[model samples]
Target: MDATQQEILERLNASGKGTVLEALDISVVEATKEKVVASMPISSKHLQLVGYLHGGVSVVLAETVASLASVMNIDTARQMAFGLEINANHLRPKRDGQLFAVATPIHMGRTTHVWDVRISDEKEKLICISRCTVAVVDRPPDDGDPLFKK
Candidate 1:
């Protein structure tokens, strides 16, 4: 990881958001300038009544991983990353197993970044895939403001 990426990762690791994400067994495995890989375990809450994973859960997980990747490159006050778009394709069903979501940078430009995220099982078969776009923008100052928590 580069210095800037490391700094952002440090901030995220110490931030409140990371703490909550961890409680859900979600974490980033690879974080760098143009790439990020996050993993999450599938649980009962993530499944449908038939015991298969819900489509929405996969989409949320994919979006979260891609967004976190973008956030790692954002400055807390000066700039932030927001999702511009997200698209996911579900290829198969995951009955019961630990699934991982990997996000790879597809495109990184001056104003936007795109990530390709894949959800896979222990067998390495892709269960779902997502393409996410995040827009980099100048963020307003926190200034001890309650609107955006510290």
Candidate 2:
């Protein structure tokens, strides 16, 4: 990765520190305008009643990476991205190890971005396939609120 890409990766990883991503141990390993990748390790906290990876975990990973990728394609100073829609199909069950989600763009337009996110196990076995649509909207004029500062 180039300096800029490395910077983005580090920023994204750090941004997770106080969010659900941190709670789920998700970290962005790769990031670029064309693609983004994140990984989450499976543990008891991530499993369902049957002890398999929960479908919701896969969906979270899918949307996180897709939304992050969409953010990269927009003008952060003037625009923001939000997940408009997301669909995931779980193809396999995993009990342990790590899950990697790779997100690549299917369509990038002025108002929206569509991302294809695939989740796979350590050995490259596909676990889930997901598609996410993100809407890019102009940033509302920043109020003095700290939450809107950045």
The candidate scoring highest on TM-score is 2
Residue pairs in collision within model 2 = none
**Model 2, TM vs. native:** 0.91
Q: RMSD, model 2, all Cα superposed?
A: 3.0
lDDT of 2 at 97: 95
Model 2 score (lDDT): 0.88
lDDT of 2 at 81: 82
- Best prediction by lDDT: 2
User: Which ranges of candidate 1 are over 4 A from the true structure?
Assistant: 1-23, 143-150
Instruction: Residues 18-40, candidate 2: write the lDDT tens digits.
Output: 88899899999998899999999
Q: What is the per-residue lDDT of model 1 for residues 1-150, given as tens digits with 9 covering 90 to 100?
A: 345655555555545254546655666666665666666788887789999988988887787778777765665457667788989899999867777888778887777989999999878999998999989887776543221355
C-alpha TM-score for every candidate: 0.78, 0.91
